[model samples]
Target: MTTTVRQILQKKNIQKIITVSPEQSILEALGLMAEKDISAVLVTEGERLVGIFTERDYARKVVLKGRTSKDTKVGELMTQNLLTVSPSHTVDDVMQIMTDNRFRHLPVVEKGVLMGIVTIGDAVKTVIDQQAETIKALSGYISGEMSI
Candidate 1:
């Protein structure tokens, strides 16, 4: 058995999630993000996943080409396709998916309902923490502080 994405689920009781209508201007999306201090917004339509808009999308699709955020609609600028995972998915499975797909964030859902977002950083931290504990255990054994 492997640890599920539920291990890395964002625990904060987020009442407000940054989101923009498909027809809304990208500029408006940016403003919402700035006000909410969020990195990405879950694009939804009355509780349906449509797409996602992230800062990377801005740099890669908009700003580099000098496209005006004010003129670009979110549906045009946002990544219409999305990669998603289930809360029951293992962290290791998520890590492999993220590494292979070059995804930084993944939305966790169960029964098609959005649960929370998990980032690559969170997975890496979990792995690092696990490694540190293993190292500590080994060091203790070598120092005769722990039994074999």
Candidate 2:
């Protein structure tokens, strides 16, 4: 059976989605990210996901441009042309997408509703866990402890 994004989200049990308004100051968004220990935050307008703000954006767009986070709006630096994924997508599918695009985070949406965010760390952990399970199952089968 393939592991789906829904399963990943269920396993993660994410309580709240951290988001910041487009009109908010970059400093405010950065503060929230710092407090949550996250490198990215979804930019929202009401219930609509407009863009994503990440550490990379801050480094390249703000810092390199000599822009101050306190004076800049998230909309000015956030990535607007986002690539989103649905819950039905497989773990492998998302892993490939993130890898090929060099993306560290992907937002999970279902019917245009933002569900949660998946970080590269989450994908790596899922793959590692899956491999461990497979190894254990193979070991059990070899030991005649379980039937295939």
Candidate number with greatest lDDT: 2
What is each predicted model's overall lDDT from 0 to 1? 0.80, 0.93
Q: Where does candidate 1 have its weakest 10-residue lDDT segment?
A: 10-19
Give the range of the ten consecutive residues with the poorest summed lDDT in model 2.
1-10
Cα lDDT of model 2 by residue, 1-148, tens digit: 6688898899999898999999999999999999999999999999899999999999999999999999999998899978988999888998999999999999999999999988888888889888998999999999999976
The C-alpha TM-scores of every prediction are: 0.82, 0.97
Q: What is the Cα-based lDDT of residue 31 in candidate 1?
A: 92
lDDT of 1: 0.80
Considering only N, C-alpha and C atoms within 3 Å, which residue pairs clash in candidate 2? none
lDDT of 2: 0.93
